[model samples]
Target: MTAPQSPIGAHVPVAGGLATGGLKYAAEIGAEAIQVFVANPRGWALPEGKPAEDAKLLARTDVPVYVHAPYLVNFGSPSEETLAKSIATVRHSLVRGRAIGARGVVVHTGSAVSQSYDAAMAQIHDHVLPLLEEIPDDGPDLLLEPMAGQGKMLCAKVQDLGPFFERLEHHPKLGVCFDTCHAFAAGHDLAAPGGVKDAMDALVATVGEGRLKLVHANDSKDVCGSAKDRHENIGAGRIGEQPFADLFRHPAVAGVPFIIETPGRAPEPHAKDITTLKSLRAD
Candidate 1:
């Protein structure tokens, strides 16, 4: 199998193993970079390490690998038990990611629940900053991905991200994984004419270009500002193909990997989506 020409890929499954299943599937779909869930995404299970398998996967290609932290991670959760678990889970994800030589570990910027946004941010800062400070220079970056703009969601809009960054003192290890669908759900309107570029501009202004690391390239099943997180296949949702072309041409995304998180049961749809996006790349 040939490696992708651009740093674009899909969130491939790790049902078998990273070396044997996930990386192989990535190659089959022409992915140059890939994202995988190292542990059960719905649980707080700490990932088991297979050093030999990790070595094999790491040695197979120069393609980048990333880890998506479990959905149960909610650093902002008001419940003390849940909060502690969230911190532990994120820390464990980082450990696993570093073992596999992943470039970054992505976690959702979670909800405030019944707490006020300020209170939630305070809790997040208390728990997250120490973790960030502990990261060795060689370890993978902890990428904060904004969630759908649901009730009391922290970092729901690009503007909401500023305070969190400030709390972390703009630590270099703290990076961002920009999700297109979530951004749209947060009311960024990325599908409208010139909307993609405008959104990129806002990101650069808010986080600076350097902190923007990965892209969760997806189409929204819901309309802009709907606060829903449903994802659709490329060009098959409310966010059509044109915005993706704009995405390809945007200078901010240059050298950044666009990892597709769209719905599909097989590799064919992913392959097609990757090809379509590649065809639209300007350079």
Candidate 2:
């Protein structure tokens, strides 16, 4: 039997319909895995997924599915209403993720808009703790994606996760979705020698093993440490192609899926990126 390698793909479009467009695109791009939004990515409203659409996605055993929660979910918000909606949004995403047989649901480690980081973290412990407790054993993991170190971001670098996991009591259902563009933006200097290895080592040392569940394989549009979240194509940005090959060789990435959220119009650019990532990981 062949050993399982990390499946490389992209965040596909679900505009036409979940199964109709997303799955069709996945097939066209030869994606082994994919990520989609359960609802409008900018809205807070919780919409029930179509059972027929859900069934079609669930039946897809060859393609592993993941969900990216709405962009508005900010647990670090100073507003009570926003906090409530954030929790609810995550809950809804988890339910929808399970309905579609998703392995994980990615959410941002949001900003501390108008408050102290300490106060924000306290509120996070008070509110998000119970939310984390609500996750069932069989449910899809809630994958926390660190930001690009812009503004008052709560979590950006790998080390920032230590405090978060400590506060959440290291919930078993909690996992990470590492974004290469964000890491490069946050200044891991992945373009430098041993950068990928050092960062992976630090992640394991802090979070221990198995918390790394997914990867967003994107190139950076800005220079390292610039705190910009712009994403370019696989090898056509500040983060050259060599670092991705380094990522593939890391032990922490075993069985993790690399889903590109890069700039593209779709089928062609991402398909080309998927091919590039496959070639980098190939033996």
Candidate 3:
């Protein structure tokens, strides 16, 4: 049988329940897949997972679901308490992910904050290894998303993830979520000749193709090497529309889902952006 088309979707809100709010949002936006926050993104409070509601969402096998770990999670935090909390939160996120049958859980590579990169990597090694060790057989893949080359952030660029993969012994459960805006912000110029392809090649070299799990399909508000994380709409941003064609055509991401994390949460704008992305795929 032929593989289904690569899904193009957006970050959807999970206000009511994963089935009701997030599922409805995906349908409204014409998304074939979606990403949602399992708990409060800005806070440390871990809420109960609604498996009954999630069952309803999962019954619709046409839509693949991905979970975005809370933004406050920093596995490399200088504070021991914060590092512990980050580990606990990631563990909880994976539990919820398993309950909901999510494809993967996305977490930021995060910052070291007043610590050297070596020190930060050590902290991450200490915290994340147990996570890799204890992932339930049915748990969702843990995906690491590199940042916009911000201060002391681990995995600030694609190349920075090599040591991390090595530390994990290239665990099968570990994966990656590449964000276009972050790539541009970190100095990978999709607009330059041979740039997007070169970047994808480098990513494959660093993380291997199987671990490339998802794409946060976004446009950047800032120019290349700015190290800012501002996201723009599909065709309106500095990255523009043409470069996305290159991204869609790249072999590294051949079957990966592209989930828009652009500015608007409303369905109309997201639908338009998804349409733009689908059109680019055929170009």
Please, what is the TM-score per model? Answer: 0.95, 0.97, 0.96
- Which is the better candidate, 1 or 2, if ranked by TM-score? 2
RMSD of each: 2.9, 1.4, 1.5
Q: Give me the runs in candidate 3 sitting further than 4 Å from their true place.
A: 1-4
Task: List per-prediction Cα lDDT, in the order shown.
Answer: 0.86, 0.90, 0.87
TM-score of model number 3:
0.96
Candidate 3 lDDT tens digits, 226-266: 99999999989989998888888777787899999988758
**Better candidate number, 1 or 3, judged by lDDT:** 3
Worst 10 residues of 2 by lDDT: 51-60
Better of 2 and 3 by TM-score: 2
Look at candidate 2 and tell me the lDDT of residue 151: 97
**What does candidate 2's lDDT look like per residue over 86-138, in tens digits?**
99999999888887888999999998999999888888899888988887888
Candidate 1 overall Cα lDDT vs. reference?
Answer: 0.86
Q: Native-vs-model 3 lDDT? A: 0.87
Q: Can you tell me which runs of candidate 1 are displaced by over 4 Å? A: 1-6
**lDDT tens readout by residue for model 1, 35-63:** 98887899877867574577576886898
